[model samples]
Target: MLSRLRDRPWTTALLIACVAQLLFLWGLGRPGKLSFDEVHYVPAARTLLALAYPANTEHPLVAKAFIAAGIALFGDTPWGWRIFGTLAGTATVLGVFACLQLLFRRTPVSAFGAGLAMLNQTLLIEARTAMLEVYLGAFTTLAIAALLWSMRGRPALRLTLSAVLFGLAVGVKWAAIPYVAGAGLLLIWGKSDQRDYWPGLSLFPALALFGLVSVGTYLATFAPAFFYAQDPLTLSRLIPFQVEMYQRQTQILAPHPYQSSWWSWPLLIRPIWYFYEPDNGVQRGVLLLGNPAIMWGGLVAVAACLWAGWRRRSRALLGVGLLWVGSLAVWAVIPKSLGFYYYYHLSSIWLCLALAAAFHAYAKGRFARANEWFALPVLMLFVYFYPIISAAPLSGPQAFNRWMWLDSWR
Candidate 1:
């Protein structure tokens, strides 16, 4: 089975996606109620189903529309509210696998990275809940994968697909705009032999084509919003609506207990408790935390990539490092005064890639066995912390203390 997987990359990718979907589906409706941000998106989706005025006006409609579609298909139960999120989460895992395969061309390394991403608590938690971040993360990751594929073959078609995916990501949240810009920049300056990669087009024209397609796709996501019976949005109202959204995002708010600076996210300094309650004589909780093995180990891998990429001129290493840094850097300059650790969700995917790249690079050295077995520790950490992160019943209220290893975690 291992040899077969290493031989067939697509099969490995599909298998990983299936396992991730099953993992996300298991106990998805636990606690039998909305958790954390589900309180916001689930309700907005319900309102969207009624075709009334938009509820979550500060953001775009793609993600809420997906939730609405899920409810429409599944009848608004806990399963209905969260079903699409599970699928989006699976898509995210597949995206990570695709990116790794394209970058490394090694199925074992790709599978390892995808597995690490799935087990890393944040993806699992977000996947089982109805929220915008999971959807945004899925689209952005897939967009990057598509951009990488363009470099291999069918440049025009693949680049168009990437543009559409990135636009869909932006429609989920404005935060995705940087990734779209990054994709354009990649085409303009990524390769010196532009004639081979982008045939029939020069530098500026290639960028112009990508930009036009992405903006058009972004506008199309607002189609549902335009038809809202009450206070329907129109072309004339679009720009003003963007200004309102920007203002809402930037406005200062009272400090949140779980809010942490962008710098602290890589260190896992704080995690937001998505749910905590006593029910049926047991304590249940869901904490938005990353797997410690992956979080800390990934930092070392990222530093290695930065050093090796610069010295070796490896596009794969440079790309992974840039994507990881770019995802987190946006938070530093964005006007949003308050941030949560969950915001690091996108960067976590790149962290997995960097780790996989490091492992693949060392696959033939004395540490080959150690590198191959790294997934064991990552998986073990997930299993050890699964109870708290998945809302499983705990021994008592103080059960969380066992997992809270750092003073800042509390």
Candidate 2:
């Protein structure tokens, strides 16, 4: 056992972390009742499975539809509806792995960065839940990864595939808007001066392909409408259904107890507890919090990315940095109410990217390696706070004490 533990490398760390995530998730399986938002989504999923979304369902059907598919197979257990999310989360980690390999191109630093992201608590939590954030995060990461691959060599079907993934990300959640836009704008900029780039008809064809996929998926979501309709064209009723979805999202600012502004998220000032039960003796509960080490360290890493961008103007690094910043800028400007910490899941990917860039720079000797030891302290912090973050075991006062940096976490 001792030798086996000693033989483990970074990948093993990620695997262990993922195993812990799975166990925690399994512990949450069929915990008797739904948590806050799952009440809305799980029921919507069940409704979709039953072919009974209201004519005016509020959000896009893609995610709920995904949930419905799982419920069909797994029969509405916690793991049932959540199984798709877990798959997406695993795909997200693999996407991050592919993206880092594309970004750094066969380097140990690239592998390390991917490992860091895999072990990340934020990614693990979202992956284990029946939430749309995991889907959004997976598709968005794949889109970015495909973009990176396209940039490194001659464009082909892979480039087209990247665009398709970009569209899927948006289809999953309109929150993907900024990241998709950033990728599209980068593609345009990359192809601008090259006369042979064929920016016109070639790109349009790929986009059309994406549109066809989107339309077919959207229509299939309303398949129930065809069951009892007197006419074959009854599927057209989905148009008004879509309009209602858009209207609900535009006006949804309902009051929520855990609402926190976007500004508060970066500092770990607010965290949404996805599931909690003080009566459960803490052995079998889940508490959600951003990894403070990764999050706070990200702020410093971003500043460093800015400095590196100004000095080197590496288009690759700049593209990565801009991708991160532009995505966050959207959250900064949106008028949506109760933008909780989970919303940061998309933005947090970029934060990890920023930290990757910082680590890459250190590995390349752009700065002294003396401060590399700083990671030890950060790792220690993650370890020290794991109990409270996971709600493992603690007195009320102990839990309260860990809420040290709260601004809006009440």
Candidate 3:
């Protein structure tokens, strides 16, 4: 079996990533309760299904429509609410696998990278919940995947698809605006003007194609809401909703207990409690956090990447630094009054990718085969903290304290 997997590492690795995400997503959310953003998204899904006036007009309909499809297949239960999320999360894991495979054909390294992507605590928590974050994260990551694929030749189709997906991502959440810009800039930077740079594809033509597809698909996502008879704007009036949503975005949010600023996310100091229901007889709490070893070590690795880039003058190291850092940097400058650490999720995925690169770098030594053993500790820590993350009934408050290593985590 081991030999067979070794012979077909890419196939094996992809399966491992997809299946692990499915099991992980499927296992949780069985407690049958909405957590945090599920309330807004799930109900919006039902409203979309009813073809009633759109309830959550601030966000676009594609992701909720996805959840609605799941509910249509499975019934209006917790499992139904989360089925699409599980699927989206699975797609995200597979996207990481494909991206890694595209960058490094080495099976061990690619497989290890995919595993690292799934091991983040915030990812674990968000993967199972019915929320816009997973969809936005998955689509943006896939867009980046497609964008990277285009850079490796065979540019036309992949580049076009990347733009389409980017549009879909934005349609899901306005938060995706920064990612779309980031992806576009990355694509532009890498596009070679030399006629032979990307055979059979012109940079400017591909750039124009990206713009058209992005606008076209984003408008298409609003089709259902546009045709709704009750939306007032109905058929041809998207401008009103767009204007209202823009206005809504500008309004400040009231104080919320779980909110955290952009700077706090990398430190893993403030984990939001999605739920606390001791009064409901089944005592449980769900907390979102990143794995300590990976997150803390990854932060150190970020610094190391900067040093490596400076010392060796390596563009690749510098690019990796730009990716994770740039992903979080958008939130730092955003004008929102309240932001949550979960907002850091899209970047955390890339941060894990950087961490995986570090592990692959360290995999040379016989005793410290980073690729082979790196996932072991991540998985172990995930299991150790599964109780709090999954909102499983704690044995006691003492058990809870063990999980809360930081006072800010309270």
Question: Between candidates 2 and 3, which one is better according to lDDT?
Answer: 3
Which one wins on TM-score?
A: 1
Higher-ranked by TM-score: 1 or 2: 1
Candidate number of the best lDDT: 1
> Can you tell me which runs of candidate 2 are displaced by over 4 Å?
1-32, 152-156, 193-240, 278-285, 364-378, 388-407
CA lDDT scores, all candidates in order: 0.87, 0.64, 0.76
Query: lDDT (0-100) at residue 201 of candidate 1?
Result: 56
Off by over 4 Å in 1: 191-196
Q: Write the per-residue lDDT of candidate 3 for residues 274-381, one digit (tens) a residue.
A: 876662466787888888867877886677666666777665566666778888888888778888988888878877667666655544657467555656788899
Which is better, 2 or 3, measured by TM-score? Answer: 3
The C-alpha TM-scores of every prediction are 0.97, 0.81, 0.92
Error of 2 at 70 (Å): 2.6
* Candidate scoring better on lDDT of 1 and 2: 1
User: Which digits, one per residue and each the tens of the lDDT, describe model 2 over residues 61-126?
Assistant: 567777879889988787787778877776676676667667665334444455456545677667
Model 3 per-residue lDDT at 345 = 84
